[model samples]
Target: MTTGNDTARTTVVVVTWRGREHVTACLDAVAGQTRAHRILVVDNASDDGTAALLAAHPSRPAVTRLGTNLGYAGGLAAALPDVGTEFVAWLNDDAVPAPDWLALLEDALDKDQGAAAASARMETAGGEPISLGVTLTADGHGADTTDTGTETTGVFGFCGGAALLRTEALRRVGGVPAEFFCYYEDTDTSWRLRLGGWTVLPVPDARVVHRHGASSRPGSREFHRWNERNRLYMLIRCAPAGVAARECARFAALTAVLPLRRLAGRNLPPAWNFRTGLRVQVLTEVLTRLIPLTRQRRAITARAVVPRPVVWSSANPPR
Candidate 1:
């Protein structure tokens, strides 16, 4: 890939929370990237020998072990201020990118000055495409693009697990919201970038093999709660009226029916009932937090060059 400017320095950040079996290989792949990048490992106070493993890894990335778990968004927030590089690439501990991933992403970004970030195609180790780019739903859920993924696909934004973000764009948007702490951070950033008049590009040729449950296991009660909690929060804080209204109705409908459904379904597990209650609690959380993030939302939306509908549709993608 051609280095468009003198500031070609790329810093790769990998955040892990008790990712013992995953961090080593993640670092190895980062070190093997076609571009010589400065790798940084942010450990969320992992006691699972992740800290020790990073110390022993051959890559020798700059490691920061926080005193407590600040979640993925917070970890990046803590590290971004100190990042002097032109671009910051994020790779979760459980995800490993192909050698040319960084090169391909940079090339795509260099060709389009409006692009705030570039994303890699995420896939399972077995070659199943996990997600191409985000396709946001009115229900406050983001669909992972899984079909006809071309080499130069454009998207609303890149997933947090495998993305290269421009440093200046992050700074302009106040960085990723640490308040989100975990889920929805990526989607929030995507919308902010779009609203801030920047494009988000997706590069299909750049592939990453991701282990889905290394940090937050899917289908667990905690996973469902955070996902539900964050999804509502995102809709409230940043989503446009149409999206938010749709999600509100969806939540309302579910809340109204779950009690009756639970009564009729005798075979439903205890965990099922518990997660259902958690979803309602998610609504309360969203309402409570919405007031505080409203100012930020207004500020973001006020700068919109890319409208909500265009972003949702990924219209006029970069050539």
Candidate 2:
């Protein structure tokens, strides 16, 4: 069990793109936390005067502004060197945590020495639950949804918007992959932690409300492109060889089935996105495979402390 001092030791890391209003609300919530904590805001080259606004705050956290937009993975990597605490909490600029959010996550970590990361329950700005529970089948392919106040064990991955991670575990597996600019970065990191003999879970009591797509316009061309590219990257890097094959087959089957199903239901936009995503997936795979180093793949394989078969079975189950 972690001691009292360990529980008190934490640093909050927030990554922002351009949502100044949402970012301000997020910081206000963190400032209201009961537990003593430090905050780090990594601004990803926002031209909307985010730096000026953060500078004007009374009790400001340490802010770092990257001249170029590094996207999600790059912003996380930038804040890593600045994280001096034993535990690090990641919050999206658009997410607001409950007052006792920090305390609950800290307690959850204290309860288990093997806990690598603990994510809080997430709800949408409209009060609908957003992200809380995640279940990956024996294969890396899986889905996530908001939980209904029920505790879950052995989570496949966590939402990067509101998750607390042990610094040592992150260090052991290396930081978040830079290749994943936006989506699936958390899944990649979580897979690494699990393979390194660490556990990730959901803390239902801790809550955060997120304004989805607050940073960018949803369903825009760029949004679809990034989401499409990153999802395929995640399957390649995290899934076991056999599991990847199965997921690929499943994905192909879905591409054929979902479009027709959506069209039948008169949902044109989704069907379009699905078809576009398939094309993007093919291009990304070809480009990524051409690279010789495969740095992310090599890093994951080298630091894996768990047996390949065990990790595979744990992440993928019999269908």
Q: What C-alpha lDDT does candidate 2 achieve relative to the native structure?
A: 0.75
Q: What C-alpha lDDT does candidate 1 achieve relative to the native structure?
A: 0.77
lDDT score of residue 185 within candidate 1: 84
Q: Which run of 10 residues does model 1 get worst, by summed lDDT?
A: 1-10
User: Model 1 over residues 1-319: C-alpha lDDT tens digits?
Assistant: 2112235478888889998988888888887888767777888999988888988887677788899999998998878876788888878889989999999988888988888898788999899988777767645586567665534456666788999999989888768788777877888888778777887887888999999878886777766677777777666666777777687778767777777777888455566324467767767777777678677667767666666666655532344
lDDT of 2 by residue, 103-200 (tens): 99999999988888998888876767778755565445445756553364457667787999998789788787776677667877887788888888
lDDT of each: 0.77, 0.75
Q: What is every candidate's alpha-carbon RMSD to the true fold?
A: 4.2, 4.5
Local error of candidate 2 at 2, Å?
23
Best by lDDT: 1
Candidate 1 residues lying further than 4 Å off, grouped into runs, are 1-8, 149-153, 264-274, 307-319
State how far residue 144 of model 2 sits from its true place (Å).
2.0
> Which residue pairs come into collision in candidate 2?
138-316, 138-317, 139-316
